[model samples]
Target: MNAHEIVAAVSSRRASAVEIVRATLDRIAAAKALNAVVTVDSERSLSDAATIDRRLQLGESIPLAGVPVVIKDNIWVDGWRVTQGSRLFADFVAPCDAIAVERLKKAGAVVVGMGATSEFACKGVTTSLLFGSARHPLDPDLTPGGSSGGPATAVAADLVPLAIGTDAGGSSRRPPAHVGIVGFKPSYGAIPYGPGFAEPFFGISVIAPIARNVADAALAFEAMAGPDARDSDSALVESSDVDSSDLRVAFSPKLGLDTPVDPAISERLEVVVEHLAKTGLRSVRRDPVWPPGATEEALMPLQHGGLAELYGAAFQKDPEQFDPDVARQIERGLSLRGVDVIAALGASSAITTAFAEFFREFDLLLAPTVPCVAWPLAQLGPKVIGGKEVSPRVHAAFTPFVNHARLPAITIPCGCDGNGLPFGIQIIARRGRDRLLLRAATRIEDEIRALPH
Candidate 1:
């Protein structure tokens, strides 16, 4: 069941919270091969469900009353282990709740356990040196994508109806695309990260939602959105109702000419554009020029630089203990001087300005969430796409820049490749236009679902 149905059932006493929690636990245990859930506290989870049941019997309203939700291991929950899928901090237990976790609890959601993430959420694929790796639920040999791989795997496997994760780049968006679920990365700070980060990615990262459908994703997003005093980045922004019928969309198969995309994925995008044209879009046309230096190559300094700032010292002490890719990124980050970061920030401003101008003529921008389908589970990303050598950040090509621009973006399942792995189409809007982006996503989501699987 989806979160809404679970809530209704629990509230009406058709399904007690304890019973639902027990069933969910059973599912998680049975799906061991997926290795999606890294840590679980059954006793506490059951006790929390019972508390919700008692409150419900006494006549209380709980929006997510009996729903079982999994949290990405990186997100702190009071008294739970938050390893961030890293061996370095494996023994550390959170002393307090992240603002996102607190909001989920207040909405009556039960935290089942921590899902897997890449070490410190530093990579696109979910493999790590600590918690191991998360496999795609549908195909055990393939990956779920990361650093939110475990959350996407759990939801895809029906281990939970909803999940909470963090998206610095496509940590949330890309994995759901691989796992065939909904991943929504709300605008920067739309969901706060207060008391959780001694130093965050400033304007880049945000807590995100992963679910089975657009509406459930939206429901989870609304529940966690809004400002928190502890979060200096938080601010109130009213969500306006948006209708796709009134909006023109710019569609890009490859956001840049040099970007590599699989031919099959490109064909799927063609099918999507054809469907959107039939739908009531004001107009569907190819995207015009985006700002130069705004591509994936431009954002690496900030992403890697921020990682170095957060974990470089620790990595230097024990390079062997860290994930090789993460350690390499930190080394690269350490090499960049302050002037390099300043130059990247200037380019970020340029990219943001480019999008601002683009949106004046279009309400949404659509592109492939990833260039290819889920590759082998052991690899970080495809070494090559369309016969060209891909950069380590290439898999994150269409995604990380969105975070740099501080915009809201979502990836919805569109179609699957020949191997039955899912493909995702992304919809993006100007910063603070999250509601509008979601509205269009739900509309396109229907067309995507109706397409031949």
Candidate 2:
């Protein structure tokens, strides 16, 4: 059942919370081949569900009563072992619940387990020494994308109705697109960040919700959003309802980046855009004019430097303990000069300003969530796209800038490629316009669903 259905059934006593959670646990056990879950505390989850049942008997309203949810391994779930897909943290147990988990529990969602992530939630593909790799539910040989792959896989495979993941550079958004699920990244600070692991992305990362549909994602978002004294970046941003008739949408196939999109993906998105235009929203083919140094390459210093700053000492002592990809990032970070970090921050600021200016003329922007569909799990990313060899980061081309600008964005499955692999279209809005983005995404999702396959 979806979160709403589970909530209604449990609240009415038609199905007890214990029954729901037990069945969810069974599903997780049966789907272990996906390698999507890192830890499952069946005992704690059942206990929590029983508590929800007791609360309901006392006449309390719970927004997510009896809904089983998985949190990304990078986020804390008090007492749960969160390895962050790295051996370095393999033995680390969380001492307290992250703000998101605390809020989820308060809303009556049962924490079933922790989802897998790329080591330190840094890479785009989910694989590590601690937990082998997370496979795509649709095709086990392919990946679901990462580092939110575990959450995306769990949701898409129907193991849970909802999940929470972190998005620094498409970590949450792209994976859901690959797995054909809804991933919503709120504006920076929409959800209070942590009492957990130190963030490598620092100011850019936000806790995101992953679910089968936009409504479930939004429901989770509602429960987790709002300010907290612990997270100075967090604030209460009232969602502004969007009027469909007055909305201005822009469709940028490549997000105006000199990125190569798979011909199949490009063709499919064009068709989706055509359908959206028929829905009465004014959408034009316009791309944001990005500043010269706003590309993902220019922003690497922040990630590398952050990793070096946080884990460099540990890495220096034993680099083998870190993921090879992450280790290289740390090594590069260690070599970066202060001016290099400063320049990257400046570039990020320029990207933010560019988007702010772009939004002045457009209420929403649509782009392909990823350039290609799920690729072989053995590789980090597709070696080529649109008949051209590209960098491993090419799959992430359309997404990082949204995080860089700290804007609200979401990815919904739009169509399948020739191989029947799903791809998604992303809808982005100005910071603090999360409500508008979700509402528009729902409309577009419905329109896509109605189209003949």
Candidate 3:
């Protein structure tokens, strides 16, 4: 059952929370080959569900009553083992729940397990020395994409109806695109971030929601979003309804970066756009005028530097404990001059300003979530896209900027590639315009579903 149905069933006393959790745990146990989950505290999860049943008996209303949810390994859940997909901290346990997890528990969502993540969530694919790799449910030989791969897999595979992950550079969005589910990255401060692991993408990363559909993602987001004294970035903002007829939307296939998109993905996006237009949601071809040095390479020093600052000493003490890819990033970070980091921060500011200006003329921007379909497991990224050789970060081209600008963005399945693998169309809105974005996404999702496959 979906989260909404589970809530209704549990809240109405038609079903008990323990029953739902047991069924979910059985599903998780049967899907171990996916490697999507790193740990499951079955005993504790059942106890929590029993408590929720008790609460329902007392007539307390719960928004997510008895709904099982998976948390990305990087996010804390008090007493749960959270390795962040690294061997160095393989024995580590969260001392407390993250602010978002705390809120989820308060809403009566049961924590089923810790979903896997790349080491420090520093890589794009979700494999680690600690937890191996997570496979796409549709094709076990292919990856679901990562950093948030485990959470995306958990939801896509039906291990859980809702899951939470972090999106620093499309960790949440890209994975869901690969797995054919909904992933939402609200404006940076929409959900409180920490009391967890040190973030390599501080200020840019935001806690995100993953689910089978947009409404559930919105429900999870609403429950976790609000002001907190611990997270100064957190603030409550009211979302207003936007008139579909008056919405100014822009279609930027390349997101102004001239990034290469696979022909199959491009074709699917064009069809989806055509269908939406017939439904009265039309968009003009417009791309933001990005400032010089606004590429991902220019803004990467922050990630490298953040990693170095957080784990440089430990890395020096035991280099073999880290993923080789992550080790290289830390090494480069150690070599960076202070001026390089300042320049990267300046470029991020420029990118943010560019998007803000672009929004003055357009209320929404549409693009492909990723350039290609899911690729073979154990690789960093596709070596070539659209018949051209590309960098490993090429699959990431369309997404990281949304993080840099702290905008609200979502990815929903639009169509499938020739390989029968799924990809998503991304919808982005101005910073703090989450409700507007979700409303538009729901309409687009409905239109896409109505299209004849």
Candidate 4:
């Protein structure tokens, strides 16, 4: 069931919150082989659910009443181990709830467990030094995609209808694409990062929702979005009504670049694009390219730099304890000079301006969420896609730039590949146009249909 149904069911007393949570807990247990949930705080979660039942008995209003949610381990929840899937913090306990967790609690969502993530939520896949690889629910041998892989897999596998994850680059959106779910990264600062010990990736990482459907994502987004004094960047922009009929959408198969795209993915995306054109959109074929030398991989230094600043000493002293991939990134960050950092920032600014210019001609931008379907669990990404040797981060080409621009973006599963793996289609809108992106996604989802749960 989606969150709306859960709210209605619990609200109408058709099922108690405890009953719902118990069922969800059972589901999580049954799906334990997926290793999606690294920690299940059943005692606390049940207590919270029972409290909701009491509140419901009193006829109190709760918007997300009794909705079970899995929070990515990177997100703090008071008294829960808030490790970012790192060995250094494997036993660390959060002193207090991160603002996003507080908001979720206030909205009556029960967090049943902590989902696994890449070490420090840094990698694009879910294998971590602290917690081993999180398997895809559809295929245990394959990855769901990462940093947010645990949360995405939890939702995809029906362990929970909703989960909260973070997207530094494409962590939030990428996993959902591979797992056949909806991952939303609202405009940066739309969901405040507050009351947490540190801001990962220097605020490029935003706490976001991973849900089975768009409506649930929208509901969770609305519940958590808005102003919080703790985060000055957080705004109270009310969601505006958007009509898909009047919107201009640009659909690019490879974003106009000669980027490697698996033939199967291209074929599936074409069918979705055709369906989108019939949905009353003023659709055009246009590729929005980044300014020369601007690439999503450029954000790697920023990510590693932030990690190094926060955990550099630990990394240096205990390199063996860290995921080799994460350790390498931290070392790279430590090796960077102030000049290189400033140069990357300047390039990011230019990339943002280029996207702004592109958006002037289009209300919405569309592209494949990733170039290919989920690759093998043992590999980072496909070594070769569409006959081209690609970097490990090559699949991220379509995503991180949106984060660089602080724009709102969403990925909805469009279809599956011949091997039964899922692929997603991403939609991006101008900064602060999160609602418009959601509206457009809903219209497109209605036409193309989300992958079967």
Cα error of candidate 2 at position 216, Å: 0.4
- Ten-residue stretch with the least lDDT total in model 3: 236-245
User: Which 10 consecutive residues of model 4 have the lowest summed lDDT?
Assistant: 236-245
Q: Give the poorly placed runs of model 1, Cα more than 4 Å off.
A: 240-245
RMSD of each: 1.6, 1.0, 1.0, 1.7
lDDT of 4 by residue, 1-453 (tens): 888999999999998889999999999998888999999888999999999989988879999999999999988899998888877787899999888889889888999999999987888889986778999888898888888999999999988999999987889999999899999999988998857657547657788899999999999998899878988888755367655467878888887666889888888877777766665665788987677778665556777778789888987787898888888888988998888777788778887898899999998988989888787899987788887898888877778888888889999988887778888999999888899889888888887764332
Greater lDDT among 2 and 4 belongs to 2
Q: State each model's CA lDDT, in order.
A: 0.85, 0.92, 0.92, 0.86
Between 1 and 2, whose TM-score is larger?
A: 2
Evaluated at residue 111, the lDDT of candidate 2 is 95
TM-score of each model, in listed order = 0.96, 0.98, 0.98, 0.97
lDDT of 3 by residue, 413-434 (tens): 9888787899999999998889
